[model samples]
Target chain A: MIIKRTKSHIAEIFCNVLCVFVITVVSVNAQKLNDDFFSPKSRLSFGNYLFLEKDYLRASNEYKEFLKTDNNDTVRFKLSESFLRIGRYEEAANNFKSLFFSTSLTDEARLGLFKSLFFEKNFVRFRQYRLEENYTTEKFSHDIDRLNYISYFFDSEPLPDSSRLFSAFADLNRADIKKFYYMKKNPDTKNPVTAALLSAAIPGLGKIYTGEIGDGITSLITTGLLVFLSANNFRHDHNFRGWLFAGFAALAYGGNIYGSAASAQIYNAGVKFNFDNEVKLFFEKHNYFLPEFDFVNR
Target chain B: MKKLFYKYFLLIEIFVVSSLFPQDRLSIQFDYANKLFQTSQYFDAITEYKRLLFFDEAKKYSYKAYFQIGKCYKAGAKFDEAIKYFSTASINAANENEKLSVYFEIVRTNISRRTTSRALQILDEIEKENTNTFIRDSINYWRGWTYIFADDWKNAADAFSKIKSDHELKKLCEQVEKEKVSVTFTKAISYFLPGAGEVYSGNILSGSITFGWNLLFGYLTINSFAEERIFDGMVIGSLGWLRFYRGNIQSAEESAKQKNIAIANKILKYLQYEYKGAKP
Candidate 1:
């Protein structure tokens, strides 16, 4: 009886242990599997790895995946950045536009948009911002202050008096002012078209009027030779030769007229260009007259 | 009952072996694809990566395989197809860095294709999605390169200047800006004076050649008349003088064009081969 009882006790304990093992195994099997493993951090990290390897397309996809689980602003910013890296300005602009109103990056986006416009050479729109659009001025005051001088030529409209043109001279000290006044008074004297035409009609007359004696003499000699050749050809009874001489005479006459006109135009343009440069140099030498934007002071 | 349990155990073991075998096959396929990619055999690499899908237990590597396939297509200059695979990888990748890499690759491929508008969009997305400074700086640097390729030198300069330690690229941008000749101004100069365009473009040799030709022809034309040989003068002046005079002007225009081409080549040569700055 004792042996049977001991055997029964051992059997019961073994059965209990076995049951517990089976139950544990079945419960573990019934538990949810992590088979649908999708880790955003891992994807983003691997994406960065590929990006560092210069595999941009793959990196872009990985970032996009990360976005599905994580809709963070920083990620969006990076996405737009990658687009711009590849020269997708239009799309990049769109992405940036969303951030344009955000306080943290609004200024950056605006500047970036401006840069994009500048690259496109859409000067018309660029002008519209300072003149027509009248967007908030406080955000870009420093940049505007720096760029205002260029706006004079960059814009289609007339320039404001408070900017460089007048202020540059007004702000000059005594010695600088004296130089500026002299430069203004002695404006360049260019040859007049009527003068050139009058001189051209009389061979050396155009060059003389334009104050170029050597050039006038050369023109007179050239015209006189051609005229003599036509006359001689006609006298020698060479009809074809006379006609050819006449053609040469015609060319000389036409060339003189054209050259004289061109010289006058060039002289005038040069005068204007020089005058502008003089004023610009005077101001540039004097620290541009106004004040620097004073970012440090601000 | 014991016999039945033995049979069940055997079946599980067989299942595990089969799964392991497929995994091994997938690993081999991945290795082969990577080798092809390393050798720049992009098309073949894409094929090998695609072949991994037929294996039973390759789901874990599916994301990497898709992304690699995109890279292969990108390397092959098939930007559109690369974009597709990259998009798929973005959806499939489990690692954030991997997803970012795919996005960046798409952007880069677009740049290589000169699709600037699209590339910019990708950059905007990256800026929005990323907070890492290194990645940001790198993207900005490449954006500069994209602008350079688009011939927007000022913008390229601006973009390059924004990056830290990007001095070389900044200098390159400045050089490009300095070398750029205004097309309109060049043409106008040529129209005003026969060889002036070439002279302005710093082609002194070609410009002097044109100037000399015109001067010589003009001198001969006038000298003939001064000698009083009317018939000989007329024939020589009309035929020889006129031909060379016109020829001089045409030659000036042609040389100006050649000089412009040379200037373009100078910039293109540096950009294409010798540039040490960031490039596609």
Candidate 2:
């Protein structure tokens, strides 16, 4: 009976061990079945991972490899996007142009091309492509129009009507846009001749009119003190002292006139600079109304 | 019975082999990632390290992978991302040595970002930890580097002095400190004598010009007053003499500061590319 019991125990142990071995082999096979390292699909997933990590160069290479076997629009767009992130605008534009005829991503690709042009500061070509009928998208018309108006602030293009120019901007930005438009249309320019005349009438008055109060005060004090000293010396019969002070007073007056005219020009330049900055910042804050790329979710 | 025992042994062997297979695969992937790192394929190495992290079921290589990812980001000059990964590595460190290494990397990244104060703060934190003498010495070494990068050669010298009297870096720092001009002293001398500070700061040409203007204008003002030409004296003294004197002081201070910056930058550039010593 004891022998029979021992034999049965040994058989049971053998069966249990066999079951464990079979489970291990099956699980290993299962894992292998799910992983296909060399396949294009896996490469695309890996590329996306790298792109998310901001490793654009490697991501672009991976997308390029995947493209050899696949002609997917999303991958193409991503490849161009990778180039765009790395500041290779020319290559990005070319890649995006290829997708401009794709059925599903044509609009996005066209917009991407415009963005590439804008980033490259080729505003003229951007405006030209924007007006092209082939590249127009009904859904994104407002964005394109906003970009059109914003371009005027950077370049020498004449601004359009306020209502039409700011129509595409959000309501919150209407006041700022209107202010910018008004500044562009009727700039607060100080006349250099007027500034010089004002300073001639009153030493440093022209600088004050040009918004340089500190310089105006200094000029007034310096010139006034010298002129007063000259008159007082002449009253005391000190001709040499009077003449010396008189000469310095004349120099101060001449310098004040020249400085006032230059100040007016500086004021006008500052006005232009501030206006340009405001318009650029407005568009930048709104991202030019462009749609955020939804590549990750897709 | 003997046949049954033989079958059982065979089955146990199969189970043991199968379980060891995944571990072996994990080690191979880890080595592959390391090889990529060694070749400077930082982006690809990052991907491989991530793969290793993903497949490592027991989390054995998790901290190591994170540390490597930090190093890759650092190589790419992405200091913010490098700090993020290094922080993760520190949190997952299994031993004090690993934690210390991650801390060192974080400090190095901060130094590259030019956030020297933040790097010093991290070093302070490392010093507070229960670390060995070797780690403490390393901390002081990097602290000296942080000060050097900030152009604070005096403080750098002091930090390196903690390592040893004859340390190479300490000597370099001391030499730089000795060669630097004192901006405050230059400005102070210029206050008493116009253009003197500029001359002391090695700008002799400018100093001579400033001195000549001050002297000419001073003579004119004094002569005008002696001749009872009050208006001429007032105008010349206030406008010409005072302006030159103030300008002399300002230029002297500026030149001294610039000279010190140039000296510091020369040493820093040498340390960055040519020095054969250990660096952060």
Candidate 3:
């Protein structure tokens, strides 16, 4: 009697285990087997993995696919941030712009849109953001204002009054900012007209003023030699040869004058390039003085 | 009989559950990614491959997924990114053949990116790693291709000749080597006698015209000096004779360089349009 009861109790437990096992197998078999691998959840998980890998181009593609089926602000922010990272600023701005109206990410997206425009060097559009979009976030307006002041240094936009531009930056950065301000205000420039006039008086004198000493000296020698040859041949009654030499001398002298003016223009271009490069480097090293957005990275 | 029936039920349940698992799902994903690849939807294919890599917890598909992603990148001509993924594939490679396959793609990428030095460097490392005769022949083949892209026909011919006594590419390289003009010879001959280098470089009319000008100036300059016209002689010598003489040497050297460039472009065109072998 005892053995038979024990056997029945053991059978009851085995039956229960088998019943649960059969239910699990049937339900699992009934569903699409690979749905878990390609479902929205897996996509988000995969997109996040690619996002963390800093493969922004691939990450953007994955995020775009994920966004097609889901409406998640964090993923949208990440997608826009990925575009920004890869220098696709237009797409980045458009994507960020989509987040502006009625979302918790409105402030970040607004800042991202402005950042895209600013980094694209579209200063005109960046400054006209409020007018163009009829949108502004009270939260990030001051940050945008800082970028607005910073943009003036990068482009040919007229600098605002010193007090206004200075007020946007912190006191700690005042010295460096003032240096850039002064550089933009009183940049050293050479006059092309003066270069031409100087070369007209003395062949190669303009080139010397433009810092091309070798070219200047070569011009002077060539012009002076032809002039001396013209004078000598004429004194010796070689009339045709003297006329030939004079014509050549006139051409060399005229070419030198024109070259001097062109050289001065080129010099001025170099000065502007260096100044622009310096400003670009400073801002790049300083992250353009924009506040760090660590939300998307998180 | 009831105990036997219970055992049978447990077996059926275990088999059903185990069969419906990640392995089957992962296999489907790999095949799906390959289908996308076959359709030339490279970017989508990469996404799918990455999808496989993401869910492959056992890492069974890691090497294949990474390799396919690298291939997609290579197809798009994004060599640097392709190289990064290929190196990653190499790291995940399960065996010698897989590693060689990854290395070949990397070297090929470097070649296409025109970083031939790096390509050769990797080939050299590969050679040192495996000295199997057949693999060495394959390495020599790529080395030949590397030299061909670099425009070093002599070395390319030498490398290919080592593979076969008369390989088609080796013959082409040799033909180019024989037909091309020599820069040093052109310059040296022009320095010794003006117009000769230009004539050798196939600039006939230019060579003759330059020769006539130099000869006329030469006579005039010597005559001026013979007549004791020192100033005239100095002017003619410095201005006319020296100008044409220097211009001859420079023009000849330029012609040689351009001829060599033409030969290189012809060979490259043949390779791009006509050759049957796999190209970097």
Which has the greatest DockQ?
A: 3
Q: Write the number of the candidate with greater TM-score, choosing between 2 and 3.
A: 3
RMSD of 3: 4.0
Instruction: Name the top TM-score candidate.
Output: 3
Model 1 chain B: ten consecutive residues of lowest lDDT: B49-58
**Given candidate 2, what's the lDDT at residue B143?**
96
Regions of model 2 farther than 4 Å from truth: A1-39, A50-58, A82-89, A115-123, A138-154, A161-183, A189-206, A217-262, A292-296, B1-62, B72-81, B109-116, B144-276
Docking class of 3: acceptable
TM-score quality measure for candidate 1: 0.40
Residue-wise C-alpha lDDT for candidate 1, range A200-263, written one tens digit per residue: 5686666566666687788778878888888898999887888888898878776776676666
- The predicted structure with the larger TM-score, 1 or 2, is 2
lDDT tens digits, residues A259-298, model 2? Answer: 9999999999998898877777877887767788777434
The candidates, ranked best first by DockQ, are 3, 2, 1
Candidate 3, number of clashes: 0
Cα-based lDDT at residue B144, candidate 2? 94
**Complex DockQ per candidate:** 0.04, 0.18, 0.30
Instruction: Show the lowest summed lDDT stretch of 10 residues, model 2 chain B.
Output: B11-20
